[model samples]
Each structure stands twice: as C-alpha cells, then as structure tokens.
Target: MIVFDLACQPAGHRFEGWFGSSEDFAAQKERGLVACPQCGSHDVEKAVMAPRVGRKGNQSGTRNATSPARTPVASEALPPEVAQAMQKLARMQGEALKNSRWVGDDFAEQSRAMHYGERERETIHGEATAEEAHALIDEGIEVAPLPFPVAPPDETN
Candidate 1:
C-alpha cells in the first residue's frame, strides 16, 4: 500500500489516502471516487512535497551540512525601503537636535517654565513620563515625545 497526500480544492484541507499503487490512485481519482474527508468534495489533488528529513549526521547523497548560513554581502545586498525611510528620519532628527539642548530628567519642569514665560522658549528634548506628558498637554503646554530614547550626554563618556 502507498500513502498519498491529497488536498481539497475548495477548502484547501490536506489529508492522506491509502492506495494499492500509483495506478490505483490515478484510477480512483479519474473515476471521481476520491472524496475529501472534511467536506465530501471530489475535487482533490496531491499536496506539494516538503523538504526531506534524515538523521542529522547522515551525509550520504545529501548536500553539505556544515556550510555557514547565507548572509548578504556588501554591494550584493539591497537596503529595504523601510530601512531607507528610517535612515532619512534619523538624519532629520539629528539635524533637529543639533540646536536643541538635552535637559535629562528635568524635561517637564523646564518645558513648563518656557511655556508659562518664566524662562525663554527654545528647542529642547528630553525624557518625560506618560503622566508628565499628559499633565503638560492638560496645562496647554506643547510637548511631543521623541520617537527614540536618547542617552544623556554625561553618560556617553
């Protein structure tokens, strides 16, 4: 007996069927004797065979098992569109932050002072909690969260 992997066309359900031989399977299919066990549909065909399986150390009649995983080399590699977009955004952010000062944890306080005219208004970006951001917005302060986290300048060294 032979086992054939069959798939139903309408529902795309795969199943195995037993037959006496290859000719037997073909005859049964031609005569419309094959039926999908799930939906009783006669439209069925053999499913695509997957990769072969064998013992890990077995090397006979098989491709090399020790080859390194494929990695795209420079010049041959292509940058994804999203990667290009992110690069452009990073460039824009770097330009924006070129003149902005980092206030570390005192982002909310300094921002509030600038907003209320207690201090001169200037471009600034720093860490602020969700609650602090919400409070700033509630008090009519314009604050936007940075798309990425920044390391404090003092910590970089």
Candidate 2:
C-alpha cells in the first residue's frame, strides 16, 4: 500500500490517506471517498510530503520515494583493495551494533542529551541527517556513522 499526505482545501487540515496506488488516491478523491479527518471536509488534495526514501533494499519496505530501477553496479567496478576494506568495515559495524541500541530517528536528540549529561551515555545507532550529525559534532558530542545500514528491528522479524 502507498500513503499520501492529504489536506483539506477549505479547512487546511493535513492528514494521510493510504491506497493501493496513485490512481487509487485519485479515484477515491474524485468519488468523495476521502475526507478531512479534522473537519469532515471533502475538498481534500495532496499535501506537501517529506521524502522517505532510505538505503536500497530496506527490509522495512518503507519506501518514501520511487526511482527508476537500474542495473546493479558490480563489485568489479571498484578497486579490489577498496572493496576488501569496505567489506571488512561493513562486518565490523554489524558486530559493533550487536551491543548498541537502535535510536531510530532520534539519534540527534538522544546523543545531545548524553553530551549535556541530561542522560547517561551508552552505545547507540540510528538514522541521522548530515546536518544533525554535524551539529552534534560541533557541540563536542562524539557521534560516528555506521559503515553499513542495518535493517530496523521492527522490520527484521
């Protein structure tokens, strides 16, 4: 299923509607099957949405953006030394995360808390924007990114 951010034109209340595809959303809206959750307004349209795309082949199946599928780049495209080093680094990160907590999208907030002594410091791994990571580093908070992405726990089982 696909989810779209919807907004009521009259009331301007934003909400989400799930459908099987883009056509599904259009059909429902045309049929007045979609309505604003806040004011029960039927004059709803698509709202601004955040890009939700993540690493390719995410086990979570939470694709936020679609890209034209492309052929896989072969390992032969990289220097042998680089490929070896990357493989080694990926394994190391996977092992390290065995003891680290998955903080999801709250990495910046949680890491800052530890830096400011608002919370106890512990190993954590999570998704963080480049800006958020830089901010934490600027604040003298120690944060490092994983060499490889790990599937979210919720989607792993």
Candidate 3:
C-alpha cells in the first residue's frame, strides 16, 4: 500500500489518501470516487509532497529547509510520556494482528463477502484504496484500516 498527498481542487485542502497502488488511485480518481474530507469535493488530485529522509551526518544541530520557519526545537519537543504511549500502542497493534490474515489488495472483496454473508466472518487485514474503504463504510460493512501499515508478506523482500 502507498499513501499520496492529495489536494481538493475546489477548496485546495491538502490531505492524505492511501491506496493499494498508484493504479488504484488512478482508477478511483477516474471514477470520481475520491473526495476531500474537508469540503466533500471530488475534484481531487495528487499534491506535491516532500519525501521524508533522515539527516545526512548527525542529529546534533541541523534543520531541514522544508520544516516551517521557527526556532529550533529540541528532540525532546515530544514529551517522553507521549512517545512511550505511542510505542505501547504500536506494540498492542502488532500483537492484535499476529494471527490476522494478510489478504493484500483483495481487502475490499474479502470484506464485502463477509459483510454480505457470502463468506464466513474471520479476522483479516489488507490494503485498500481510500475510496474503497469509504465505499465499504457507506455499505455498512464492518471494515476498518490499521493505524499503521503492514508490509505485505509477499512483498517483504
């Protein structure tokens, strides 16, 4: 799965859209399936985003140009409590999905089957385009996305 920075053409609201692949995003956009969450506009397109890269040399005293112009913040800007809580949440998620099936990009189909009673319900997780996820929600399907993305087993290489 991949995430793209998206913008609403009408309102110019910038947001993120997750997709199984670039083609999935294109197909959804072609069908006018993606809408801006802020303004409910379907005229959405990919927005320019800076790639996240690690610091070159050391983390001593350096700031990237992309960061908003402001006084330098120490690494401790994020409270230790908040950081620890986030780590705990990640561990909990990992444990929860230890036995879940990785259905890769067939998430929408598999979820719909279970939702319509065409297949028995079971624990499963996989990738789906933002539009697909929204569609499932609209159909009252009990599907949800993981807080953090997992690498597909087959693509781990």
Tens-digit lDDT track for model 2 on 1-157? Answer: 8888988999798777889999878765654567775565889988989866656673766533675656776422556676788789888887898899998889899998988889998999887766787888899988775545466799796
Residue 19 alpha-carbon offset, candidate 1, angstroms: 58
Model 2 ranges with Cα > 4 A deviation: 1-80
Task: Give per-residue lDDT, candidate 1, residue 59.
Answer: 54
Which numbered prediction scores highest in lDDT against the true structure?
3
How does candidate 1 fare on TM-score?
A: 0.49
Q: Candidate 3 regions off by >4 Å?
A: 1-77
Clashes of each: 0, 0, 0
Give the least accurate 10-residue stretch of model 1, judged by summed lDDT: 73-82
lDDT of each: 0.78, 0.77, 0.80
Mind giving the per-residue lDDT tens digits that candidate 3 earns over 1-157? 7889999988798888899999989976764567776665889999999875556675756566787876865432446776677689889888978878988889999999998899998989887877888899999987765645577787777
**Candidate 2 — worst ten consecutive residues by lDDT sum?**
73-82
lDDT of 1 at 2: 73
